[model samples]
Target: MTIPAATASFHGIWPALLTPLKPDLGIDLHRFGLHARALVHAKGCGGVVPFGTTGEGPSFSVDERRDAVDALVGEGVPASQILVSTSCAALPDTLALTRHALAIGAHGCLMMPPFFLKGVSDQGVIDCYRQVIDGAADDRLRLYLYHIPQVSGVGLSRKVVETLKRLYPQTIVGIKDSSGDTAHTLALADAFNETLMVTAGHEPDLPELARRGSTGAVSGLANFMPHVVQRLAGRPDAPNTPHDVSRVRLLLAMLGPYALTPALKGIMAALSGEPGWLRVRAPLVALTTDQMHTLQHALKPIALDVDVD
Candidate 1:
């Protein structure tokens, strides 16, 4: 399938980076920059997404997030390459974050509907975004609706997306459907196609989604497996290498035994040999000793060169 010129611009792997924490649990800005830089330079990533779900976005204060973005851009990562997820439950915070991203010349903002109020009316969802768009009052802002009902408890209905696009045609550019439902993913791709950039959050569907007109990914796994994702994103017609499928299987195996964030941090620690990499904020703890041992054992096989010691 021919990718639209607009969609093609954003097509490639954008890793949802893991925010490495200091031993005192402070934001490790230097380590964060290193990670983001490595992804772009070494892993050949399209861009880096800071303060998304995998980066523990909700756990940090606005200042912390702002500082992290500062660190990333300060490291010479272009604003055109950084897509910031500014999806706060509060309308004011969301606006503030998005405004900051735009002010810094970020490529765009990935926003989730106000997810604090469960069972919100469709109009309520629409109004929340409307307030931000109108409040921010920036024509330069490119907004991508983030759909991850499983995590956010707020789903981006097709009607909501269509309405936003109809109202703010140029501003509303895309949707990140992390719904992880293939049927829903296909439905969104079929409905929006070139009109709106539909990036699949489900990594495995990337190849098929690419074939069906979906453009790129804002993937968590891409943080650790950027080259694997690069290969996966190569072309829809290409076959999945054995390495790709096995790597994905290895990641999935970790999910059942631990929370994804901690597991990912644990794996990152194994790769970087930095114990502080395992620290997480309150309400999210480090992996258990047994889990770490097991994760190291399991990861060694998949990440052959990584020192799991």
Candidate 2:
């Protein structure tokens, strides 16, 4: 079978969307749909990535993730614009979610290597992905290798990427480098920019990557600040590059002191004036009162408007 070239339509800012929850910590499908629609139709984001790291992907089970994707589509968020993060610690779960995303006609899937074991060989990583591609057995599969070593403990090496691309070129279409290392990201772009869609998950790196033909991001900051991320990814030389870069850095700095996902949720609570946004699954608690107050004060300087309805 002839492998087509990487997709051109995957370019632009796709927010790693925040998963809103109810007071009981159930997935709030109503608010979730609203946010997805707002990000694409109103905020000018290229699309939204749900159940990603920022969205607490692993915290939710396979069924919850599938149902939310269905609700998002039912509520008018086009499946073609959504990049579903179908990674799971177990191979069976990963295969199930990947098949579901393909069945729904999502633009693609963002999958990390099997993360339960650390320091696995490159061949082990390759074998893991091969199982998924072969098990999915779907010609429509368009996958982005998700590289976030700090979080996943297993990273995709250059050689591993090359081997997989060689074997499954059609299914392996792109890479999302959340390595948080500027040089590594640029290196991936340098090496694979011709044959793959290389996108940054680190917001500050957007300008530099954009200069090298990477015009997309799966950004956590875009959850509340989509326009800013979109502008940064547009062009490295855009006059507002410095300002946008600084703004993202400042906001990200606020997340440094707290658990990242909760800190982001706290900000969302403030932005939307809905305290329910503070709810997180177990093992991840909501921000404290003082923390919320501090976050609100920190955000006051940026004057961010609430774009999600």
Candidate 3:
């Protein structure tokens, strides 16, 4: 299939969307679409990233992810505005998800190494990616490597990323570094600034990274605070002020104690006054009543600043 000219380069803030679930714990396709549209049009996000770490990508089945993508696009969010993460423990499953995203016209695919089996050899990592790129073998496939060692336990070494870029220069485009280390984010930009599009997960460092040639971010904080991320990304030379930085940090601090996905969902629920937002899939639990009250208290200033309903 002739792919449309690459839909906008992978630059600017792309929120790692927080999946909204129903009471039955099924994906809430309606709320999902609403969130995508609001983030892009209202909050000024360049686009939306579904099925990333923040979106709890691995927890949902391939069918659910596919449906969510279709729902977002059907709701009038352009396919170019969606960056789908297709990281699964199984290769066939990953290929299926990647192919589906490409067929549907997503901006690109953010992929991780087969992370379930940790301690994989370097060559093993390369070959794993090779199989997916070669297997899908589609011209439209724009793959962005995902390197969040803290969660995935599989870090894409510089050598691995460089080799892949050398091998699949067109198909393998960039990476989302969620390593949470400024030095590592800076080094990746320094090394591959010209070739690879590096997006930092650390929101505070986005402006500096952008100045250093990194493209943008796939940020968790942007789920609620896209304007902050957008403002920082839109003006790379002028970083966010200390007050802006503190506000972002405050939200991070408040949510840091709880399991992140649920805490975020609770905050969303409280802000929107939609109880369904608190529903998470198995292996994840919602915040307790006490915790919900606490999150509300801490996030009050941020909620006012963001002007959420």
Candidate 4:
């Protein structure tokens, strides 16, 4: 029995939150809660999404993922403020992940098509979602299709979006297009105006989308600069400030090549005046000593108080 809850309004800055870890690489639920809270309080940030590619969702255990959700809910962050991206490579795992996220007070789920295989058809992708939504069995399990074919090798085509909405109009709520293509994102917005709140994954395109019915962004830029993103994404009437956007881009540039897990931890560690908050799992290596120095030098003028270890 699927419990269907009314879908809530979505469209604003959904930050891909950074997960803090202990030096030995254990989940620091306490710090995780603080980060969630921090973003919620930021100007224009609608809420936080904790398990996107930037959040290292693929690298975490099921328990770790659930615990992250638990921490946020326990901290009094409302479900409306969380859009949990329960993207996993396996159908069963994805279903389990969505179930957990919904159970832990997340209002919606962003699902990437299974990436373990290539050249999958829209039918297969639709079936994967059918299984996940079936397992969720609740009104709160609002599914937002995640489209980033460049990485996932599975793009959510127009047919897939239309078919899913037709099949489960209420259950399938929206989409986050990280395909990095303006044409595709624009097309989705034009096709499904009210039925699906299509959002851009890129920050620069927020205003353009807002004009075209795009409600907001699920942005990597918001991880470190939620306030800036919230300004452009959250405040629709505010005039575009090129200087403001450029400032953020400049600061983000100092973080180095944009493989974010380490740079984010490093920033958190620096700000908190603590050690180990910056430590991350292996296979996602940390900055080298010289690299760290370069980042420090590059980021020096940004005026944050991050310290060296």
Model 3 over residues 29-78: C-alpha lDDT tens digits? 99899889888877777789999888999998999999999999987788
Q: What does candidate 2's lDDT look like per residue over 1-309, in tens digits?
A: 111355777877898989999877889999999999988988888888999888999999999999999999989999999999999999999999999999999999999987888879999999999999999998989999999999999999999999999998788888999988999999998888878888888889988888888767889888888888888898679887898888888877877889999999998888888999999997898999998998889888876634756
Q: Write the per-residue lDDT of candidate 1 for residues 38-134, one digit (tens) a residue.
A: 8877767889888888888988888888888989989878888899989887888889899999899998998888777898888999999999999
TM-score of each: 0.94, 0.96, 0.94, 0.87
RMSD to the hidden true structure, all candidates: 2.2, 2.2, 3.2, 4.2
lDDT of 3 at 178: 89
CA error at residue 217 for candidate 2, angstroms: 1.2
Alpha-carbon RMSD, candidate 1: 2.2
Predictions in order: lDDT:
0.81, 0.88, 0.82, 0.74
Best by TM-score: 2
Residue-wise C-alpha lDDT for candidate 4, range 1-309, written one tens digit per residue: 111234445656788877777866887888788777767763446788888877888788777888778888887677768888788887787888788776666768888988989988879988988888777788756888899887778898888888898988888887888887978887887787667787887666676677776656788767566666667665656765465556666765665584667887666555566656566776787656676666657766765322222
lDDT of 4: 0.74
Better of 1 and 4 by TM-score: 1
Clashes of each: 0, 0, 0, 4
Of the candidates numbered 2 and 4, which has the greater lDDT value? 2
**Comparing 1 and 2 on TM-score, the stronger one:** 2
The regions of model 4 sitting more than 4 angstroms off are 1-8, 42-44, 236-240, 248-258, 270-277, 300-309
Could you tell which candidate, 3 or 4, scores higher by lDDT?
A: 3
